[model samples]
Target: MPIYEAIYRSNDHEELITVNSIEQHEKFVDVKNHLYCTYQGCTARLSYVPKGKVRAHFKTWPKNNHIQDCTDYFERMVTANKQKSIATSTMALSDKHIKSVLDNLKRKRKEQESGTDKVKTNRKKKPRPKVNPDSFENTTLNIVPTTGPEADLTSGENNIKEPSVRNRSLINLSDDDLNWTRSVECYIQNVETDDNRAVLELRDGNYTFRVFFEEFFFDNAPINFRGYFEDLKYLVQRHKEYLFSGVGLIEKRNEQYCMLVNRGNDFRIDDQYIAIFLQNASA
Candidate 1:
């Protein structure tokens, strides 16, 4: 219990009055780390007090009367710190999700090493067929970009081509997996831990686009699709147009984009919307 020396303005005039107390000073400081100082002319000794209590103190003090400017400083600092704390909390959720994914992968690798059957009995292993003999146009997941609110970092711009040619990594899955109607394999393209989304180059070889989200991740994840329905619908419809345009000219130009929205799992937009548009537009 250390004593605090405060210079407070008297109600009658701008003159300062000294208040020496251990209890009152401790009571005024609220934040985890309380910093204190007095106004230019007025000497007010503030202490460890809850914010609510300080507001209550403000009410009793006359608004027109000479009051300590320290209150205003405290309020501003408190507001800024509160906003920072909120941002910190929101970012933590992504950390938890990523940690879970990595943990699951590790667990999966261990299970496989134990000589467990990794493939399901109903599923058959097929060799990678030459869908696009060039091999450059076969990869479904090219680049991972940011999407949604600043949960992890920032949302991705709606672009098809990436900007520059940096270090790029690609993984090609068997074309048979894409053909399978019963099951779909999802590839989640994640940004590096440095908090940057990878840009993807388009099939044109010269042009590239930012892949914010692909159908596989969207279909597999539990998402709140209230606002994302339109974006998703627009994305799928654009690809189907390419698939059927002028005797496969579009597919030859941008590659085949066959998207199937699972109806049973749709939480927001109607799953049939993309299908209906594709059907009508294709004919």
Candidate 2:
């Protein structure tokens, strides 16, 4: 989420601050004070991005903590809706499911605000995990195959083998079967640099699927493309295991399958609230 305003908290005072205001009074602000998402009940830290070619703004990290009903929280929802409106035919998840989830969360928030929910009370916020940069220095990448027939790594332009089941691993899906709506797992094989673009390769069994982060990819992305792409590279390089869930169309080019990650909410890395790999990656 591209947060514009943030909550500045200190021992003596708490106040709402906007990116513009922060810039206006940059020298007078206390950097040591805690900066959080402006929305009530949201604990996501908002890092200030000073004005450059673009205007100053607040940015959330990969490990952001936002309440489900926060406006910043709905950025992903906006992406989902935008994707649906633009390409309803390619979407895998049902609209009804998304709407139901939103409605339930809104109702729950309302109940808590009205003092109707007795089970809920003010509780201490969980401490954010500390990441150690030295830990991932010498880590070896390990990819565990799913329990089934050993994936055949056949040599050819089209390495995918037709899965007997409709809902199957991503690598096991053929060009024709990419439209089915389901949660499928794939192994993070590699991240490669292709000219000005980035390519993420996911493998299952012997077949590898590629997702290209090119111009079209950036057009649909919700965050800063360059910064987020760097974060993704760092994430994949540091973590050995992660899961990516999203909605997109699968295109076959030159006998190879490529996944189009066209929306912000269309995918999650490690079942995280956001797309970047933040959950358990440091651990």
- Backbone clashes per model, in order? 16, 1
Runs in model 2 deviating more than 4 A are 1-167, 178-183, 193-196, 279-283
Winning candidate number (TM-score): 2
Which candidate leads the pack in lDDT? Answer: 2
- Give Cα-based local distance difference scores for all models: 0.27, 0.51
Write model 1 residue lDDT over 1-283, tens digit each, in one string.
1212233333432322223232233222221122223446433244332221011112112122224454443221122222221211111122233233334434544675797624432245453333333333322323322112333332232333321111111111123223221111122222111112111122322222222234443554545432233443454444422211000000111453322222212111112233453355446
lDDT of 2 by residue, 1-283 (tens): 3567777877777778886676444432363136788777778777665543245577775466578897877332222222221211111233333333334444544776798854433356554444453443333222221111222322121433222112234423554454333334455667766434766778755567776556655555554655655666777787746554444456676677776554455455655534335434445
For candidate 1, the per-residue lDDT at 210 reads: 23
In angstroms, give how far residue 268 of model 1 lies from its true place: 14
